[model samples]
Target: MRIVVLAGGIGGARFLRGLKQAAPDAEITVVGNTGDDIHLFGLKVCPDLDTVMYTLGGGIDEEKGWGRTGETWSVKEELAAYGVGPDWFGLGDRDFATHIVRTQMLAAGYPLSAVTEALCARWRPGVRLIPMSDDRVETHVLIDSPDGSGRKAVHFQEYWVRHRASMPAHAVLPVGADRAAPAPGVLEAIGAADVVLFPPSNPVVSIGTILAVPGIREAIADAAVPVVGLSPVVGGAPVRGMADKVLAAVGVESTAAAVARHYGSGLLDGWLVDTADAASAAEVEEAGIRCRAVPLMMTDTDATARMAQEALDLAEEVRA
Candidate 1:
């Protein structure tokens, strides 16, 4: 089967591992969100894409679910020693090599899509991981600073790593989204997919950012295949990450049903909610999409595989 999955960071990467286990022979294409990409120290760091690559390639810190395994921080420490700081975002020594290669290739005039392909050649993530767009589409969060100087926008990483999503966000902006074209294979992957899934990622900033790229949302909406999404919310809280805080920025309630409604039946054909939110299944179904209540926790590989299977099963049910 050909599966195309729209993904974010840690949560999406872990789920992709389970999806691989569930269907080892399946051809998987991951449309990774790049709105979290940041230019630091003259190198571009794509947090979400690198998260997926490292996690799947077995180079990832399984405990942190981001960055490299057996990592070191000499570079960061040295920079801090020099007072060159923004020390909030952690970048390990091993992970720095990735950004180095990516920056080098990009400086040589390669688009991000090509650079990603070259990078993946080394990792062999066992899936085709494509950025949502070659053009820059940075996600910025509008928040009030400590000085109460009214609302100001900061890079997504600053809001996430520094502030830890502590403040209320007035809006999440995907700068350059209006002019950004879908990366070369994104639309094609969606069109040719047997099943398309939105992993239980940060919907507003991750998957939402991917959709914000021109032509992506339209392609998914028009695709003939089933587009299923697993809810990141379980009992009104995110499985991991402060998704509720960002969701509030978009005026969307952090409920399974609300998330389903936010994606809407127009683009999503199926939705999966945790068994804990089974009561909301009826409302989700009434939204003109197939709904299922399943155990959606990713506590371990086995649990995540079951969740992946449930998403695929729901897709098949909806398609039938």
Candidate 2:
């Protein structure tokens, strides 16, 4: 089986782990979100791609669900001591090496996809992990200043990592996405995949950002395979991250049914909601997408694998 997944950071990475366990023989291709990419201290950081790579490669800090395990923060501490900082992002010593390598390769004229491939050569993430676009497409959040001076746009990292997404966002857009193309193999993978999945990642910033790439969404919508999604929102709340805040900015309710509708029946063939939100299933189905309710918690590998199996089952149903 060929599986294509549009992935974000932690949630998406965890789901991919389960998917790998559930379908060990499947050829999985991940289109990682790059909208969260930011340049910090003259280095390029691709958070989503690194999260997925670390998680799959057995280097992830299991508890935090991001960053390398057994990490030290000497570099971060050194930077802090210098008093030159956006100390909000805790880039550790081990993590700095990744940014250094990526930035160096990028300066040498390699596109993001090639750089990612080189990085993955060490991680061996199992799947073919590719960025959504080699071109720069940053996600920026528009928010009112704390002092009420005026509205201004902030990088996604600043808004999320620094402000902790506490500010009410007026809007979120993938800056430069209007001209970005899908990274090499992204569209081809979608075209050849037997199934496409939208993991329970942040809808607005993760999967939404990937879809923001010019032709990626249209390719998935046009693909012959079934396109299915697992809900990140359970009973009117996100399982992780401040997804509700961004969902609200997009004018979508923080509900499973609403999120499914946000993706729309035209793009999604099937949708999965948690058993707790089973009532929302009918509403989602009524939106012209097939919907089912199952246990959506990723409590452990077994539980997450079960969820992955359920998604594949739903894809088969849609195919039938």
TM-score, structure 2 vs. true: 0.99
**lDDT (Cα atoms) of all candidates against the true structure:** 0.95, 0.96
Measured with C-alpha atoms, the lDDT of residue 74 in candidate 1 is: 99
Q: Model 2: residues >4 Å from true position, as ranges?
A: none
Tell me the tens digit of each residue's lDDT in model 1 across 49-137: 99999999889999988999999999999999999977888999999999999999999999999999999999999999999999999
Candidate 2 lDDT trough over 10 residues, lowest sum: 84-93
Residue pairs whose backbone atoms clash in candidate 2: none
Number of the top candidate by lDDT? 2
RMSD of 2: 0.6
Model 1 TM-score relative to the real fold = 0.99
